[model samples]
Target chain A: MQAQDLTTEVAGLSVHLLRGGEGDPAVVLHHSTGPIGWVPFHDELAQRFAVHAVDLPGYGRSDRPSWARHPRDLAILLNRALEQLEMDGVTLIGAGFGGFVAAEMAAMTDARLRSLVLVGAAGIQPAEGEILDQMVLKEEFYVQKSFRDEESFRAFYGEDETGELADLWDFSREMTARVTWRPYMFDRRLPHILATVRTPTLLVWGEEDRVIPRSCAELYARALPNAQLEIVPEAGHVAEYEQPETVARLIAEHVGSLA
Target chain B: MFISYFTERPYQDEQGEYINTLDLAKSNADYNPVLGGDLYHRYLDEKVYAEEMGFDGLVLNEHHSMPACMGGVINVEASILARITKRARIVLAGNVLPIWDDPLWLAETLAMIDVISRGRLVCGWVRGTGRESVTHNTPSPYNWERYQEAHDLIMKAWTEPGPFRWEGEHFDYRYVNPWPRPLQQPPPIWIPGSLSKATVKWAAERQFPYLMLATEHEPTKRSFEYYDACAREAGHETGSQHRGYLFKVHVDETEELAEQTARKFLQGPSNPFLEGNQGQVRGFMQNLPGMNSRTEVLPTIETWAPAVARGAQRQHKKILEKKKMAKGKDRDYSGSYEEQIAKYTIIAGTPDQVVEKIRNVLEYLRPGIIAIWDGDGAMSHEDTMRALRLLGEEVIPRVREIGKELDLHSPFEVSPVTNKPVAEAVGVG
Candidate 1:
């Protein structure tokens, strides 16, 4: 299935998303590195479910809502977008920075959210380790760190000789800097607020996830009332990006069980 | 001409083994307070001595989380200078506006400095480098907007009879009143810039003296001309008094001694921001997203607009020049000593040679105000004092003579704010 590029207005913002697949709806919110088109994972997930890969405001081709300054603001906007798109009974999956936004949405309203899957999400502060500051490291090095193994990283990003990928990464990082600069990626009150969210949650973590600490997934599991933590070995921060087939199998099982 | 003494007041120490300049601010492990305290006192002493040596202004600037400049909070140093220095304008060139969440404090503190200095304050504002946004945790995207708002807020807080509420987009206050207002009625405002055309235009529109930091001579001239054009468009007459030039210059009794001492400017921790340090360009930190819109990388020299350049022609030229820069040629200053001398970015010689070099700059740029940047990097206290002595006793007198011959009058001689002679403005010939 070929992913079709589409745009939907959410609270006056032109949100860019890629739509492909069949069956139940699974909305994919991109990581802080920004959306890099529909990848192999999106295709795999598309086989079982209708995957909607979204570029959050200030990211990709989406019209940036200049007024929005926090993940919570993005969450409210996304919830409104889902409502506008008439997407109910949705399985919301978010990775990295997007995961933070997804968790916020789930906490705010479970109206359209049927199930939640957070992969190495950054919202709740980790007890043991800190979220790696993206600004401190070079864009190329930072993206490379996202995967556990060399082959996994090269497979997804390829050898970027032209610095085009680096430019995209920088553009995305700017958006990340805009919203998440002050308190960084985590919300102080998110842990408490997330406890009240009754949405069935599945927390996925790359065993070697270096960006957002692996302990963050454990924290998210603790925060959510109905959530289970699954640690995938030989994977990094974006486990879905690295081990797509395994992550897709896990998501399929989680969503299938929910149905 | 209004001449000032300037320095980064750098902490002289060996750089860490693991860190580059981009990482130096956060990752540098080689910082000692004992050395820092001594250096701070030493810098203050140099400023005091610069005033004693007859510098018209004692210029100080601010930077954060970096060893390049220990003047983390310039107002703090300015307050101390206010008490110590009897004369010489406390030229803040200047405070980083965007990082200050509460500019009310800035207003109050500056007001106090003016009060203490008995009105010898030339206030300046800068949109700080991207490192500031990162270290201070300010939103980089809103840096320019915040800088503008903060500038407007501060101006209003100073000029307008207060207790008036300020409801700005970035900042707001219920009570916009501060005690002990600045003695200089709104104080003489100056804007210093290197490359950003927006800043140069903004300064020109306000009729503020646009102090050009160490830029290539040709670009500096072009920038001044651009400022002139901008000022003209704003319906103001501009002269040399409306522009200023700052460059690294050292004078000693002997040429060899001068060059040796001046070479110390490149001795400190590698600073990406400093021209001579030539640190690796960490594009992400330097070119923060919204902070710089033109390109998402290091601005190449020649392609990058100088302290001066103007209009649609300049823009077209820049576009062509930028294409050249994109090819990864002449990316930045090499920070080599020979290159520094060749580009005239650094001038180090005997009193005669230094004066001659100063004349060349004066003739080229025709700036009313000139800031002799010295005492930076690892130059010792003695070296700085000797250089100041030569500057005050020899170079300054010659420059003053040239200033008259070349018709260069500083803001004091000719008010930049009014475009009228200061004597006329004050009703005294």
Candidate 2:
């Protein structure tokens, strides 16, 4: 499926809503580099759930509003986008930095978030091995040090065999630059807020991931009383891109089980 | 003016044979699940230690997907260097600015570094080596033109009255002002090149320094002559005052020991194992007018190897397999200390001999500055420290003495810290 299949709008200052996918309401938030065209995984998820992918303010097609100073401001702007979409009683799936936003939404909002699924999510304060510090400060650091193999690089990037790998590579780099480009992940208080998220969560991680290490998954799984951990082998940081079928099946099953 | 070792210490594998650059880069992949943070921290630590050792400046450069040269992002190194050495000048000896989406960010980042370090920043601009720009998705047809435009934009952003608009062929901006102004009045600018007439002329027009890599002495001398005449015609003073050269140096207790050390070092496997990658270098240089001509520019491995092999066959009345082996081995010396120094493009000797040889070069070239590339081939930390000590203590002082004889002034003079001059003579501004 092409990204053109999805329609988008500015839900608030620096925030955009990509509307498509029909079923039980599922809010899909993207990582940094902004709102992208719909992926096959998003399409698959759309088959069973109404999907709403958000472009955080200052990224993607969203406006770079001056009011959005930090990640909390981003969290507030994300909440407003949900309000604009009139989205309630939804399952939230966040990837990379988007996962941080999803976790924040689950923790703070009184909205009806049925469940949370964080795929290669980044928000928890990592005490030991924090890739965020390096990723945010120096992009080349991540590019040079992250991927283990050519396959891993290609997979995490989510480029298909269509020779559009060049464009996708540029997009992946730009996305990384946009999200972690400033003050990095978010305020240190974010991990403390993770404890308040009562939503039943699924922590999905790529075994070969470098952006957010697999060890971080164990931390999140331990912190959230109701969270489950699934390790996808042979995948890097972007597990959804690498193992979309498995990720989709897992998500579908998880959401169904919640019912 | 500065010498920093490009350490390849990590290439040492289990068998003690130095691994190729490609394998070294790939080796990190094995630890991808665990050691990313440690590797990054170690990289930073190396740069920080370089500052503590008291080099005039720290150097970081960019190369992509090449194992021999792992510094893929020069800016990242610059950032780390800036944080550690708050007072020392951080020189990114020409980032391939043309490949970037916005060179203004480079200017802005440099400005921020200047502010953070209170003005100890020097910016170098370059068009980059051939074929490397392809990975950045930069248009090869317009590389030189884009480089020129990017250089101008960054300069204007740094020097011009800001909040002004900038509309250019490549960039359009309504607000041209960038925060954190550079402290050095204007941070010093240096341009590094080998055989580009356009680059030479540009540096000449601006009266900025030109850093020449070690090429054949005749062509290098001729290039400097052309640079001198051009600078003079432009009504600018010309001499070694702004001319520097980058060369590899290996010092040992004796000449024999130095050669032995170099041979052992050269025997290590080459980094960057990709096939057809060497064509990138050839394709890049072939585009430049003077460099495009095989005879005009100095011969590299591509031109030199087959010729030498053919010559050896003619001499022996048969194709000697050993000659081919030698040629292959020579090609692998792209990152070797011995090959670089033995060619006299770089200098290898005991500290005393190195000092004497450098003095000879100064007499012949009269360059204003001398930049030493001690960082190559994963040089050991201890060896690098020793080289720095010898350079700072022995070589630099001797060079200064020679400068006195030539009536050349030192480029660096102490910044007047106290207001004694204006305070006593006139009121402070």
Candidate 3:
């Protein structure tokens, strides 16, 4: 099936949704650090499952509610929007900061979610010495530590500096600032809340992830009774960007098994 | 050998506008300076364009906190290139692996790229420049040792049979196996250098390709000789068996126009040390020890300017200084344009002249492969395209003819067109 086009709404503090495919429902949440442009995982899954990718309330084309306190509030609002759209029984896929909201939504909502895919998911506070804040924030630092060679960096980020899609990142960064302005991360109770999520979970983390440590993926795996872990080789927090095909394949296989 | 073009903005006016050596550099800020989207787009086009042009291999390198050289995060470039050029051989002429305490992560990411590109990976090991190492707080004195160990460990993960224990000074691991084995058995290895003894000897012993960036004839010749001699002494084959050079290239209709453009773009009021000299020397020393010694051998800036000025008066004085300090025998930068054309070592002429020069270099070096390093000093897109179009349509065919005459295997082949539509495939594009 062809990929769906993007549509918008004003329900529960305005949200933009890109709908695609037509089968078992899958709700895709983009990272707070970027727009809700469905990553490769969601794109691949769209071939089978009916996919609903939503821009967070404050990100992409979504209207930001001034009263929205944190990502959890955004998550609650997403739950309300899902209800309005009647997209039930979704296999929720959340990456980075989006994972934080997915965890909260899983805990607070009673909606039917088939499963959950958390990629380099962020929510739990990292152990001392395991998390390196300085390395994560600086582009040079992360490039030096995460990528093995210049080619890998080029592969992760496109080689061109003057292409049409180049400026898409500017909008991404602006969206990130809007959602995660005050504190980049969420509450410390995120893991405790995630533990209550009984949805079948698949945790995929980059072995070289500096933003959220791999150990944290392990922690999430242990916390969720139905969770399984897959470590992407040679990737950072943005594994979908670096090794999209591999990540897509994994998602397809896992989601296919459930179907 | 893989060739990746690097673009740099060498000249900065007091008003903050950068003038490029090659007209192509202007594109870096042409679309939108603050947004940086245009610059990124141009880079992507270049990589895809290079692949379509039929380069045997393409390369990308890393640098940080410098405007002159803007490829701060090369992985970003590589990831995009992988999607655009699914068939071309891609080389990350290196990642400064030593700076990161955990290099395994890099190994994993490269392995993923290898998978994505279907195994066309050329691994380049580097111990970043002094300025970068200092700024990042990565140990400099032991960078070489760290780089060597990292190389050994990563290779083991890529090639060796599974899950072995790895214990080294910098990194210690109980399990050393990596998944998704690279497609090209052991991916080809190339070491970039300005002229470092340690790197030359290491590459020579292993018979890996040697890449000389921004190098001159005299020092480059000595380096080739040294590599050859070392290989011979070690009972290994050498010479052009695995040697390549990287230089800023610009080809126009006339030599005078190209030189004039180069001079106008490369000159301006930028600080020599910050803008050019120190980074060049420091990058050489840290990554290539042999180049450090060579830097001491060549003539100093004051002495070499007069000599080079006679030939190319518009040349950057600091560049001449660095060239003078380079070590190596066969110091032959003197000759009429025609005489230099006869040498064919550097391509800096019209299409025919450039083609002739490449043929001569190929004949003289007889190296297995050559990489054209065309990125430097803010070469503009228009000029780059002109050179690329000329080379693809003219220079490459002539070089193939020369290779045939010499009974050498052609380095590239045009892939046949497929019947399938691109939009239908899964990750095929």
| TM-score of every candidate | 0.93, 0.51, 0.49
Query: Relative to the true interface, what fraction of contacts does candidate 3 keep?
Result: 0.00
Predictions ranked by TM-score, top down?
1, 2, 3
In model 3, what lDDT does residue B89 have?
76
The CAPRI-style docking tier of model 1 reads medium
Give, for candidate 1 chain A, the lowest lDDT window spanning 10 residues.
A161-170
The local lDDT score (0 to 100) that residue B25 gets in candidate 3 is 21
Better of 1 and 3 by TM-score: 1
Query: Quick one: best lDDT, which candidate?
Result: 1
CA lDDT, candidate 2, residue A249: 82
The candidate, 2 or 3, that scores higher on DockQ is 2
Q: Report lDDT (Cα) of residue B288, candidate 3.
A: 19
What's candidate 2's DockQ score?
0.01
Model 3, B1-429: lDDT tens digits are 233444442323344554322211234444345435566676668777877776666777776554555556676677677667877777776787766677777787787777788777777776565435544655444456777898888888887888899898768998777776777556767787642467778777776767765444555666678878877787775444366665445567677856554432343422112222222122211221111222322222122222221111112233454456442112333323333333332357677767766666656555445666453444566666767776667666676677667644311221001212324432442
- Per DockQ, the best of the predicted structures is 1
Best by TM-score: 1
Candidate 2 lDDT tens digits, B103-176: 77888888887777777777788776533553465544455667888888888888887888878766777888
Q: Native contacts retained per candidate? A: 0.68, 0.00, 0.00
